[model samples]
Target: MAKKQGLNKKLILLDLVFYAILPYIVWNYGKEPFGDYATMLISTIPGFIYTCYRFILEKQFNIAGLFIIGSLALGTMVNLLSGSAEQMIWNGVYLGLFYIVIYFIALIVKRPFSLYFAVDFAYLQGYARKDSATLFFQKGIFNWFQLIQVVFIVRGLFMAGLTVFLLNKYGIDGYGGMLLYKQIAGWFFWMLITGMFIYINIPVQRFLAGQQDKLQDKKTPLSTDEIF
Candidate 1:
């Protein structure tokens, strides 16, 4: 059986430092010295390097990792190419819109991305993809998966709306504060989503284990006398 991996506290701390703290620090402090455009570009460097390092360290060659890498690459490219801080901020809003569209399309097709992500997680925890999918689609549990997909869409929209508000209110000068607020908001949503997932998963996992035990019982052969 493949060992199930849990959240790494150390990595989470490192992520906060690199993704949120360092970036905010760079944006705020670097702005005067480097100017808004250059400061914004430089602020992205820490998060990009940390993300790549994490991807490599975890040896994550899976779809989830690919998605992260792709998004990181795209964001990096946007920052590099964008002529001004304002453009870079707007580009981020556009990317969020793009992701919202993809989520909506997945919902329309009745093939939510959240289901696939859950299936992938199960696969990592020693479940076969087919088996996990079969279990995940059980009528009782499947609705939650769809709900998760909706949550993703909502999250995207919420962040996009917040970004627009910040941009209009503070403009480029508020970049550091925006980054901090976004991080805080992101953490809140993430916790809510994770809790929701765990609530559904515990009972489903127990049922799966019971089914597996029954299968083992059926496969085990009795001695001749005992059978007779």
Candidate 2:
């Protein structure tokens, strides 16, 4: 259990740094290599490769992998078309639009894409408890998916809209002048994500913990791993 938890933490840190912090760092400093367009390409490439490699290594093609590939493609297009700081950031905006479309489609299908992404990460894309997690997600303790569906859609839209507003007002190059403001806004988005995760999933965890306790008290031979 400790080993798995450590691996999970490492995976999460790798993903966080590559997906968010690294790109931000590169974009903040990469202009020294060539220029803005090159920096944009450089910023996205490492994360894209790392994510793809992780999926290949695990032999699991999941939603997160798909998003990474899609972002890379989008980022490449943005790099090719970028004539200004705004164009450089359009790719990220496109990514937001993609999520918006995906979230709504999942809701239409009554499956809620947010649920899949969360489960995938929780298991670190391993086979362990995947089907069980899917079952649990579909059975959905606390009606978590139903509750979070609207929040996911609205939040995605709000984030995309806010990012566009910032990019337009500040310019991608606004990092040059208003770097702290951009960093603070970036942290705001991260906090929003963290808050939403806790608010939406804590009930599910609590309920599961309750179930585990019941199983313990009943002296059932079954473990939570089996119930997962």
Which has the greatest TM-score? 1
Candidate 2 local lDDT, residue 52: 74
Computed on alpha carbons, the lDDT of every model, listed in order, comes to 0.84, 0.66
Local accuracy of candidate 2 as per-residue lDDT tens digits, 4-119: 77986787677767766777788878877767777766767777788678868875446756756676576667667776556656666776788778778888887765566666
Candidate 1 residue 140 Cα shift, in angstroms, is 1.6
Cα deviation of 132 in candidate 1 (Å)?
Answer: 1.3
TM for every model, in the order presented, reads 0.83, 0.59
Worst 10 residues of 2 by lDDT: 175-184
Instruction: Give the residue spans of candidate 1 off by over 4 A.
Output: 1-9, 206-228
How many clashing residue pairs appear in each of the predictions shown? 0, 0
RMSD of each: 4.2, 7.9
State in Å the error of residue 36, model 1.
1.0
